[model samples]
Target: MDRTLTTATTAKIADAATAGSAHAVGLAEWLTRRAARAPHKPALTCNGITWNYGELIERIERMSAVLAAGGVTPGARVGYLGLNDPMFVVVLFATARIGAICVPLNFRLSGQELAFIIGDAGVHTLVVGEEHIAVIDAVRTDLACHCFIHRGGAVPGWESADALMAGARAERSLPVAVPVRADDVAVIMYTSGTTGHPKGAMLTHGNFWANNLNEMFLWDMVSTDVTLNFAPMFHVGGLLCGSMATLLAGGHLMLQRAFDAEAVLHAVAAHRITVSFAVPAMLLFISQHAAFEAADLSSLRLIAVGGAPMPEPLLRLYGARNIPVHQGYGMTETASMITFLHPDRSSDKLGSSGTPPLMTEIKLIDASGEPVTAPGATGEICVRGANVMPGYWNRPEATQASFTPDGWFRSGDIGYRDAEGFLYVCDRIKDMVISGGENIYPAEVESVLYDHPDIAEVAVIGAPDARWGERVVAVVAPCPGKSITLEGLHAFAEGKLARYKLPKELRIVDALPRNSTGKVLKATLRVHNVATATGSP
Candidate 1:
């Protein structure tokens, strides 16, 4: 009854199987190995439908076969435009199975922005949800694609994924001929660039797997843990930290189309979810929900929050409610959580993003490019680890500028690590706002305001808000000899910036406070914007 392969035998088997096949360090193999070890374990559960490890692996293989049959090949960019669903997870693994890069598009992006990412990635086949069929149709001419697959239902000339998946035979794919290495690019996630465009960050399979292992190591997760993932799949935090981590751990994942506080709480109680990921906004809603006092949330063993800082009030609420949430910090360039504050320390640290994960190295560097070696110190945060992305797609200048000579990623955010290794972020080098837990780069907003004719000069900054965390505030200098009002400025930006980035308080003045050298000082505006807006003439 000894069915176990010895260590040497296992190594030999792996060497023989992966001899010429691409994806040597791939998650496809990970799924198979985990399935063989525990086939009955649940891998995904969405809207009451469940798939075990065995079933999940089979679906991935079949889907990959369908993709390959449809002409997807190694290095091809396959785009996915949908909300979070099991199919999104399936598409990720399927694309990786063949060494193709997965491009996850934001569902909320305008058709023009979506076109840029799809075109930038050179994606030829897009898999979108039926909800976006109209949106995709509007921009299909701009998408440099050959075909499309609809996730929810059928569309004209586009294959229906749900139907195809239902009819597709479940069988493991024949081994790929060439091995996909750890360094091979697995995904391309688009980040809003400084130049009013989006840049695709090329992340390898190793990047995704390494981050998963780091989180797994930090939390010491077990098979019994169930993670509820309501974050958007297109983002690194959602696909990697939320869903991918669950699959990598061979645990259970509960999927959501998007973050809905009531739905999230219901899923937790219904599935008895033990682990979960949420941003500060989602956590705040849960804290303020009517069910907060009634719902038995004791099933949650661990939680991680990111995309914004966890305010002191919210952190205290979770601690008092017996649901401690670890704060994590990272960006699209770094595969999800670069550093994590474990749940146990959620209450203790109060405001830190915890220490770097096991495989990651974090350093603080002064403006002179020298490392700051102690606590209560502030400097630009630099990270080096397997979880770091390979580079941006087709952006050599950006890739070169983003790193130090030695290889550490130079994060523009300023933070300091305590003696105990907890990271405390103070300010960002880039003028960005984390209003309602979403990144709002001021440059993007400023560009929107620059188009207004009445505005001679304008600057936007994040101002404190009691309810919304941070609200975008814009200050404008009226053109000389021309008259303009705050209401007029708000009307110009109403349709331009996203609702969250829309200026909450607008100030029209004779001149925006600027430095002597002619640089608009944002630091000065943050204070003056509040003072001047009190009584506008």
Candidate 2:
């Protein structure tokens, strides 16, 4: 049977599912519908436990009851801090069930950072895993959250989620799912905020629904497909990119607490996983694993990759194994993916980020705000779509500055379209380095250095220079048993890159600093470089 769903077929399925419903767009409704249709089907698996659709929905309903009983009403903010687990998914649906907004906190953030977000969102109730309870405790006095619920074993002052859920089930009084409009806010996802404090992006139920439709149009997702999701669920790439889409399609989702390259290989083979999502760094680690060549990965039909471009070497490695890696472009503000390069065209397009999804529109605009119509003419990428967030939560000025007067959401990334309309992302507007009188994109420079045998990982950043205003600096994590020097790097790239684009300095490190989602922290690197240069502690 053909698994690919056409746009009209997917729309019909959605319409039929919600024909008479007033609150059809609420995300929790999707689980309810799926459970009614396929109660016995495996829906989620984590840490050797599997929950079918029926059991999953029951858990969500009970959790919803517990939250409502604890004073979480419509429009309230509920924060969740934990590793990737079925509970995270449950809390998201449970919060949405009662017309509350889910705030997924990054597990890797410091206590201070987490406190800022919890306070900013004015979270009424916060759910956390036992491992993270201490972090929350450190900042408990600073937060306004009234209720603390623990996911695992009991804590001193926190309510036990397991016990509350048991009590809720015994009561047999499931609260009726609240009605929500399509544009009603369902989640307040905070950005990474490399420059300043993170801003919460208010994503509506319709934004997620539109993203799911876009994924269904691009991927051959089916009920039988088993998906492995090990990326951090706090990020858009991990949650909406493939995990939620799989659940919506009635597919099995195998969750991992965190990414372990060897374990990922074993799970794919043991479970015959068919679909997954990861960043390029995860793919590189998987490819470099000792068992990669021998692992049985034939069951994987699609591996949706975002966060960064997949290096050519990794793409070829996966290609030889017959596993397709689809590259996509998106951010927290865009729900998940705006553009997806089909695997069939991966080779031809090479570095392109594919075309906009079915319900999204993308354009490029010059610095003067005029359309950049000619192919290969680089400009700031812009997007206009239902999937786009309405605005940053409670920050009207920031939201206004992020969009054009006509309503297109400015992406802040520099890119250009080929004649075929495929987007080639150059670099972020802020990351672009201007030296003397010329413009340079660090991504372009990093792409070249990535091919060097001695470089295991590299990030190109600009450092202040006396003569040129700014100079290119290559920060490299050398391959094991290898070392690199500025002279050697220049020699290797002499012919490949322009003289001005070549790195003016080299800094060797054991590993590059990265966020949980595997994006190199260039801002951190720049700050560290400045401190070292100035001999600051």
Candidate 3:
């Protein structure tokens, strides 16, 4: 595919985007407008099935009718539990069409854990993939959800998504897209919190639009771009970065259910994928795969990395292959992107998280709650932008505590800025762990393990891992005369916590180091364990 655009064409595309931004009220309207503009263009492909823009919109409208027929109304929460598939996108758009909120649950979570989020969100309708039906079934009795729709296959006591869509199509009439304002919530993404429970971040349609515009201006994504999406759609980085941006730009999407390093390489070569988003771990795995040296990656124009810093060695490896790695920084609250480092400066500003996006603002404040004006002064990173979420769902206290009185979102991250205004993140105030792009709150993991009979007292910390960016290390004071094994702890916490959040390394201490106020001195723990926090069973 030719990836060239003349000056006039570039200007024309920018103008079009600016004009569309003025009129597009929500995500549902974007698909309708795009289909009208390019009905025959391929929009999404997954599981050997391809859907053009025209067909895709029709499917969305049919799904919307199905949802409406099931009593789904504006402001209702609709949950989706699945991997990366076209139907996941369908549910997102379909929910947006009816002005309902889409709650994309992490498929990796345990059934009980999933129930808490579903109950907290008050989800009225849930759509589950076949692979996850058993998990949901185990917790069905505990949930107050009204409707359960299963995709991929039929299951007892569940509505068939395929059957519902077919019926809606046969009915010949589709529900009109609901009129929604820019500030209306499009998705309620749950982020694990320091309080040992997940908080749903209410991301508005305007937030998504702002992030999309930021990416379009920086990444220069075009309709000719073919993006391969293997990142889990449950995460904001996966849903809002390359996947939604590519669709908003009218590009083609090659959707994969999960990330497979070998498959990613093959797909990039065979399909000539031009743009993709991945975490550092995915990139590391891809570069280490046996096919890395032989795979053809000439078609790749940009590979965006987030969730963790891109190690310099991996950056050099990809740089040698002539593939530019665009490192970015953001969180679920920011709709996935805040600061973006263009590939041009990726090497020069090696450890920096780049500058704020076109419409985003980044500032650092010292411990005294004052702005740190001098370059290289360490402070807590704060953000202010249209792309930032308005607040957390139904958590007024959390919403208030997360923002300063002046309206800036407190990122709970410590970083410094260079003289050139580049952001360099150093530590997290909440001690959240980013293991392979998934956010794991140490408090949450510790809470689960505290219930273990063999564990008298426990504190979880993230230890540096070469491959996974960081590995969960459980520092424990075992019960008197009781020995705890890593396997035993894993088995104990198996159904209570997500597999990724499980302790990879266990450390036994006579007693955890604590300050006068009785808080665990995690810094001391990190200093001692980081060097030895290697090897996972």
Candidate 4:
């Protein structure tokens, strides 16, 4: 059966049974319930403005009316280009309330890239933030989207988002009633697409709801907790972990426009935030800053880190301060986290990404596609759960290729599980180097390199070789005012790594290029090496 047709049929049956009150369990309904349960509790805070649950719900309903008036129909795609502001959240829930799919475009993308996403998603209406007005204007002619709703700093011809909300509020109009089903797609998030063109991961309402349950159960979050969100909302990490999780718990969310080491520290101190989700690089910067030692982090109960591995030294630094750095492992396809190393076990299970939640199942498979049951046996990590995305939007072949015969979603990450079921990520399947018939996971070698005192950052990639098929190459970024030699690195890794696993070549660089989420762009590095050696522009 056609997916949209099935959804429409289900919605009709549900709406008829409950008189249009039977819309599926989605983020919009989640917010409505929270408002009814605790109307006076703080829902969101940003730019020094606070909104209680009742106020936030009212605004979302009005925004829904605005979208409805603008001709956004159920199942239509609505795009949002903005920073990490409250308006982003408002638009997110508002779209869901009216049964529209929300596509939040990456602000860091070039005009061409942004235009591609906007065009591909078939977004008829756009909500733009002040910071990205010029970017959208440049690509406006190239895009197929219509009806721009400016969030702030409005251009002369664009409609004011705030004015629309005020008008809706004054009119006291309710949102157009529509039946949104659980299986309906709520978001179409474009992946980073490290290898090729980006693909949009279609996350259904059920997928996101299951992910929220996983977070609340694994992290032990409660309604009283105050979470701080600094990551960009365009990413799944920020959307699910920072915003959705907090709201699902009926907790207050303190939003930051963007990440600044000092600003994050100040927000935590001022807001008495109980939890924060950051990338490993963000944690490293925060720990090394001067304000870190003086910042009052007494109220912080958890610091969950993801995007990349947390260096051992940084993990130890937080452990010494009586703080735990919980490691998380997931990707856009899994709706953020598939496993989370609990804070209490962070030290004991160092480098482990913990166990899957009650609703999820994880396993590994060898190259031949057989299951790896032996303890500590490495294989491609596969996940089975409701949290897994439905499929990549409009990419049927890619979507079919991403799953196993039995329906497990292939994670593309090579990893293993210990005797106790704790997951340890080895490396990406593409990143593992086969040198002279020996398999060398770069993450293992990189973990050892991180201990070198003179090395600030490191990325291990496989360079082409005539003798070994592939050679292990270490791209080193030196510590401030410090440098490292090839001999020094070998000496440091002598006992820590096997002979075949050691890096055979060292290339010094000032810094490694990272994406907005702080994961080193290894693909970019690989391309640069090839371009330089071949003298290609």
Quick one: best TM-score, which candidate? 3
Q: Which stretches of candidate 2 lie over 4 Å from their true place?
A: 1-19, 432-537
Per-residue lDDT value at 488 in model 3: 86
Alpha-carbon shift of residue 515 in model 3 (angstroms) = 0.6
lDDT (Cα, tens digit) per residue for candidate 2, span 1-537: 122333433343344455568676679987677666666689899999888876777778779999999999999999999999899999999999999999999886667768889999999999998899998898899999989998976679999998888788513566767889899999999874434467899999999989988887789678898999998888887889888888888999999999899999999999999999987767877888899999999899999988766777778989999998999988789998878899899999999999999989999999999999899999999999999999999899989989999999998899999998999997676676655423466876787789999899998888766445467888888899997888888888765555777888888788999999999989899888532221101
lDDT of 3 by residue, 352-447 (tens): 999998879988988778999788889999999999999999999999999988999999999999999999998889899899999999989998
Pairs of colliding residues, candidate 4: none
List model 1 lDDT by residue over 1-537, tens digit each. Answer: 112233432343345444444443576666656555566678788877888766666666667776776788899989998888888888888888777888998887767667878888899678988888887898787776976999766567789876766555443333352347888898999887776667899898888878888888876777778988988888777877756767767788888878888888888898898888877877888778888778878998778888887888887777777886778998889988678887777767877888888878889999989999888889999999998987899999999989998899988899988888789888889777777666677787788789988779888788776656787777778677776566676677664544665677776667777788988888987765334573121
lDDT of 1 at 165: 63
- Tell me the TM-score of model 2: 0.80
The candidate with the higher TM-score, 3 or 4, is 3
Looking at model 3, report the run of 10 residues with the lowest lDDT sum: 1-10
Where model 4 places Cα greater than 4 Å from the true spot, the runs are: 1-24, 170-172, 431-537
Report the alpha-carbon TM-score of model 4 versus the true structure: 0.78
Winner on TM-score between 1 and 3 is 3
* CA lDDT for candidate 1: 0.77
Model 2 poorest 10 in a row by lDDT:
528-537
Candidate 3 shows a clash count of 0
State the local distance difference test value for candidate 3.
0.88
Give the residue spans of candidate 3 off by over 4 A: 1-23, 529-537
Span of 10 residues, lowest total lDDT, candidate 4: 1-10
lDDT score at residue 280, model 1, on the 0-100 scale:
80
